[model samples]
Target chain A: MNESEKTRRKTRWFMLGAFVVAGAAFALIAATSMSKNLVYYWTPVDLYRAGNKAYGATIRLGGMVTPGSIKKLGGTAVEFDVHDATQHVHVKTSSVPPQMFRANIGVVVEGTMLRDGYFQSSRLMVSHNNEYKAPAKGHPVDQKTLRKMMESTEGIKD
Target chain B: MKTAWIFVVLGVAFLVAGSYLGLFVAPAEEYMGNVQRIMYVHVPTAWNWMLAVLYAFGAAIAFLFTANAKWDARLEAGLEVSTLLAFLLCCQGSIWAKPTWGVWWDWDPRLTSVAVLLFASIGIIALRGFVDDPHRRAVWSAVATIIASVDLPIVYYSVKWWNSLHQQQSSPQTVSSQFHLPLRLNAFGVLFLMIGFIMLRTRVANMNRARETALPPMTEHAGEIA
Candidate 1:
C-alpha cells in the first residue's frame, strides 16, 4: 500500500482497538464501583444503620479511639472502643497497643463486630501523623529540672 | 502455547499446598490471630503484581531500543497479566483488610496508588486499541509503560512515606524465620502462574496479529495478454 493508504489503515486499526478497550474498561469500572454492597469500610453511621447485620462480618471500622475509655484488663489485654461520633464499637485485644491508638487519635480496627455490639479485634494499628509534624509549640525539654533530678540520682548505682 | 498450561498446573498445586501448610502447620500468630493466615495469599499477590509489572517495564524498554515486533506482544502480555494480578492483589488485600482493619477498603496511600495503577493500566490497553500502526502502537505503549512505572514506587512505599495506617512489612518477614519455607513456596507459585499468564496472553495476541496480517490482498491482478 502507498504511504497515505498505510497511514489510513493504521488509523482505522487504532480506532478499532480503542473502541474495544474503551467498552471493556467502562464495563469493568461500572461493575466494581457500583458494588453497593462492597463491604469495604463502615463509617459510624453505616455501623449504626447496619447494626447487627454487621455481626459476624469482618470489617475495618474507622473512628476516633474514645478518650478515658482505654482500660487495661490485664498484663497485655486492654479494652478500648472506637466511635465515629455516631456509634461506638468496643474492641478487645491482648497485644501491646499502637501508640496512636490512644484517645482522639483516628484508628482502624480490624475484626468482627459481635452480636453484643462489640468489635472483637485481632489487629491494632495506628495512623502515624508524623508526616505533618509541626515544630514543638509547648515548652522545650525541661532541661534544668532534668539536670537537678539527674544530679540527685547520681548517688545511686545500677 | 499449550505448554503454558504446565505453569498453571504447577501454580495451583503450589498455592494450594503452600496455603494448607501455612494455615494449618504454622503456629497461630501471637498478635494477629487466625486472620493472619490471609497474609500468605495477600503477599504473594503483591509479589506477582510487582514481578509482572517489572517484566512489562523491561519489555517496553526492549521495544523502544530493539525495533522488534515481538517485544510489543510481550509488553501487551505483561500488562494484561499484571493488571489481572494487581486486581487480585487488591481484592485479597480487601479480604485481609476486612478481618484485620475491620473494613474492606480505606483511603490509605497504598490503597489509593494501587487503584490509580489499575486504572492507568486499563487506560494503557485502551490507548493501544486506538493506535492502528503496529510500530506506532508499540512505541506509544512503551511510553505508557514508562509513565506507569512511577506508580510502582508510590505503591511500594505508600505506607512508609505517608501517614497511612497500613503497617510496614509484616514483622518476621525475614526469611530466616519460620515464614521462610511457606514464603518461598508461595513466591514460586506466584511466579509460575505469572509466567503462565504471560505465555497464554502472548499466544492470543500473536494469533490475533497473524490473523490481521493474513487477510488476502484487496485487488486481484489483471493479465495484459488477455
Candidate 2:
C-alpha cells in the first residue's frame, strides 16, 4: 500500500481506539452517579427512611392519593394521605391541585415535612400512570360520575 | 423517491384512521377523560423519535467504517428527522402535561435526558454546517452522532432507573385492549411518516453534497493557468 493509504488506515484505528476509551470512561461515570443524581422525587418510604433528615428540608414526595382521604379544608387549602404499599404520609397543600387530581391517583408534592408530622406542600402535581383504561360499559362519562367511578376503582389493580 | 411518496400516502391514511378512532370512537378514559387522547400522537411520536435516533447512530457507525458518502447522507437525514420528531414529542408532551401534571414541564430524569439528546443532536447538525470540507464534516458529524447516541439507552431506561415524574412505558399489557387499535395505528402512522421523511431528506443531502464537490468554472480557469 502507498504511504497515504497506510496513514489513513492508522488514523481509522486511532479513531476507533479513542471512541472505545471515551465510551468506557463515560459508562463508568454514569453507572456510578446516575442512580443517586437522577431521582426526581422521593417516595413516602424514602421520606420515612430519611427520618430526622426528612424534616424541615424541602423535597418532593411522590405516592398515590389514598382513597377517601382527600379533604378540602376551605378555600384552596386541601389535605390528603399519600401512600405507597407499606407507608403513608399526610400532606397538606395550599396550592390548587390539578384538575386531574383524584382519589387513588399518583401524586408528587413538593415541600417540607413539618414537626407536626404532616407534609406541608407548596406545590402539588399529579403523576398519572401509563395504563389508560376506558370507562366501563354503560358507565356515565360526565366529569362528576367519571370521578366517582375512578374513586371506586381504588385498591383494585388491573 | 417513489417509495418515499408511497410511504407518505400510507402514513397519512393510517394517521387519519387512528385519529378518528382516538377522538370519536374510543371511550373516554376513566380519570382524565378526553385529555388522555393526546397519547395517540405523543406516545407514537416519542417511539418514532427513538427509532430515528437509532437510524442516525447506525448510519454514523457505517460511515466511519466504510467512509462512504451515502452513509453520511443517510446520517444527516436521520439526524434532522430525529430532531423534528423530538421537537414534536416535547410539544405534545407539554400540551398533555399542562392539564394532567399541572406543569407544562419538569426536570424529571426521562424528560431531562430527552431534552439533552435533542439539544445534542442540534449541536451536531450545527457542527456539520460550520465545517466547509465535505469529508471532514462527514467524519466529525459521524463521530459526534455516535457520542450523542450513547444517551439513547439512558433516555430509554431513565424512567425505570430513577424516581421520575414520568410514568413507565405503556404497552398492550399495560393498556386496555379497547385502547389498542388507535395506539397501534398511530404508532405505525408515525413510523411510516418518519421513514418517508428520512428517505426524502437523504436525497436532498446527497444532492447538496454533489453540488459541493462539483468543480466551479473559476477552478477550471485557474487549473488551465497553472
Candidate 3:
C-alpha cells in the first residue's frame, strides 16, 4: 500500500479506539452516580421493610395523610401521620404546608428518618395525578374536590 | 439577514410580554408563591436548548452523509446556542430549586443527566478546535456530536426512569391552565430567539470557513517541519 493509504488506515483505527475508550468512561461514571443517588419515593411499607437501613438516611416518604392526624403546633409547625393502607409513619415539619396540603391527599416528604421514629421533613410536595379540567363554571372548587370530580368525569366532556 | 432582525424584534417583544404576565398578571402559585415565576424563563430555556441540540444532532448526521459545509456550519451554530441555554437552564434551576427543595443542587437523576448533557456538548466544541485539518475536523466533530446526542434521551427520561429530586414532566394535563399562559408565551419567545441566533450564527460560521479556506494550509509551520 502507498504511504497515504497506510496513514489513513492507521487514523481510522485510532479514532475507533478513542471512541471506545470515551464511551466506556462515560458509562462507568453514569452507572456509579446513578447507583449512589437514585432515591425513589418510599411507601411506609418500604420503610418497614428497610428497617434499620431507613434510619438516619435521607429519604422521600410518600403516602396519604391519615384522617384527623394533623396536629397544629405554634408558629407554622405541624405533626401528622402519613399512612398507606397498611403501614404508617409520623411526619414532623416546621415549614408551612402547601395550601392544598390536608388529609387524604397524596404527599411526598423529603428528609431523614430519625432514630426516634419520626420523619423530620425538610420539604413537602403535593403529587397530583394526570388529569385536567376547565375552571368550575359556577362556584369556586377546591383542588381536592376538583381532583375527585376529574376522576369521575373522565370520558365526559370538559 | 434583514429578516433575522425581525425575528429578534418579535422574540424580544414576546419575552417582555411573557415576563410582564409572569411578574404582575399571573397569580402567585399556591405552593411556591412568587418563586414559581422563574419557571417562565427556566422551562422555556430547557425546551429551547433541547430543540437546539436535536437540530445539531440532525445536522451532524446530514454533514456526515453529504459532506456539506453548510450542514457543518449549522451544526456549529446549534452547538453554541445549546451550550449557552444549557448553562442558563442550570442557573435558573438552581435558583428555583433552592427555596423549594431547600438546597441549591442535588445529584438527583434529572439534574445529573442534564449536567452530563452539558459536558458532552462542550466536549464536542472543544473537539472541533483540537483537530487541525478542516475536512478531518468536520468529519470527526460530526461523529462526536452524533455520539454525544445519545445523552439527550437519557436526560429527558431520567426523572421517569429513576427517582429524582426534580418533579415529573409537566404537560397541559399535568399543569394547571392558570399557569399556562406565561409558560406558552415564554416558550415561543425562546423558540424565536433561538432560531434568530442560529440563523445569524450560521452566517458567521460560513465567514469563518471562507477565511480558513483563503489561508495557505500548514504554511505557517512548513519551515519547522523541513
Candidate 4:
C-alpha cells in the first residue's frame, strides 16, 4: 500500500481501538458502582437477617407502621415501629415525618441501624396507597371528622 | 405542514388540560401532598427524552447501514429534541426533589447515569456542528450516536441496578391508578409535540443539505422554496 493508504488504515484502527477501550472501561465502572452504591429497600425481616451487616450502614427500611407503636417525643422527633408481618424494627427520627404518616400505613425510613436495635432515621417517607376517593359535600376536605370517616371506610365495602 | 401544525395545536391543548387535571382535579397525594403534582410534567419529560434517544439510536443504525441522508436528518432532529427534554427533566426533578428528598441533587446512581446520558448526547450533537463536510458529518455522527446510546439502558435501569436516592421506575403496576389519567394525557401531549417538532426539524435539515449539495443553481427544488 502507498504511504497515505497505510496512514489511513492506522488511523482507522486507532479510532476503533480507542472506542473499544472506552466502552470496556465504562462497563467496568458501571458494574462496580452499581454493586457498591445501589441501596435496596429492606424490610424489617431483611434488616434482621442482615444482623451485624445492617449496623451503621445508611439503608432504606420499608414496611407498614405497627399499629399503636407511635409516640411523640416532645418535638419534631418521633418513635415508631415498622413491621413487615415477619419482623419489626423500631425507628426513631428527629425529622418531621410526612403528613400522611400514621399507624397501619406503609412507610420507608432512611437511616442507620444502631447497636441498641433502633433505626435512627434521617428521613421518613410514607408510601401512599393508590386509592383515590372524592371528598364528601358540605364538609371541608381537611376536617378531622371527614378524614376519620373516610379512613374508616377505606378498603371496606360501604 | 398542516398536519404538523395541527399536532402542535393539539399537543398544547392536551398539555394544558392535563396540567389542570393534575394541579386541580387530582387529590393531593396522601404523603407528598400537593408537591406530587410536578410528576405531571416531570415524568412525561423523562419518558419522552428516552424515546427521543431511542429514535436517534435507531436512526444512527439505519444511517450506517443505508447511508441515507434522511436518517441522518432524523438523527439530528432526535438528538436536538432529546437534549431539550433531558435538560427539562433535570430542572423538573430538582424542583420535586427539594421538598421530597430534602436535597436538590445527589450523586446517586440514577441521577449520575442520566447526567452522563445528557452530556454524552449533547457532545455527539455538538460534534456534528464542527464537521463541515456533509458526508463526513453523517458517518462520524452515526458512529458517535451508536456509542452514546450505550448510556441509554444504564440511565433507564440505574435505579434497579444500583442504590439510588431516586425512586424506582413507575408504571401502571407501580403508580396509583388515580394518577394514571393525567399522566397518560400529558405523556401523549409531550409525545405529539415531540413528533411534530421532529417532523418539521427533519424537513429543515433535508433542505439545508439540499442547498449545500445541489448544483449552484436556482434550479434546485429546495432552493426555489428557500
Give the clash count for model 1: 16
Local error of candidate 1 at residue A28 (angstroms): 30
Each candidate's lDDT (Cα)? 0.67, 0.84, 0.76, 0.75
| Predictions in order: chain A TM-score | 0.67, 0.74, 0.61, 0.62
Estimate, for each residue in A71-124, the C-alpha lDDT of model 2 and write its tens digit.
999999999998876788999999889998988778889999999999999989
Better TM-score candidate (2, 3): 2
Every candidate's fraction of true contacts kept comes to: 0.04, 0.60, 0.10, 0.12
Cα error, candidate 4, residue A69 (Å):
3.0
Candidate number 2, chain A TM-score: 0.74
TM-score of each: 0.60, 0.87, 0.74, 0.69
Structural RMSD, model 2: 4.9
Best by DockQ: 2
Q: Best TM-score goes to which candidate?
A: 2
The sequence of per-residue lDDT tens digits that candidate 2 reaches over residues B106-164 is 88888998999999999999999898777778888888888788788888887776767
lDDT of 3 by residue, B1-226 (tens): 9877778788999999999998898877654568778988999999999999999888876776666678889999999999999999999998887666556776767788889889888888898888766667777777787778767877887766564557667788766687788889999999999999999999999999888878976754565787
lDDT of 4 by residue, A21-90 (tens): 5488668767875565445467777788887899988988877687789999978999998877567789
Kindly give the stretch of ten consecutive residues in candidate 2 chain A with the minimal lDDT sum. Answer: A149-158
Q: State the lDDT at B110 in candidate 4.
A: 72
Candidate 3 residue B106 Cα shift, in angstroms, is 1.8
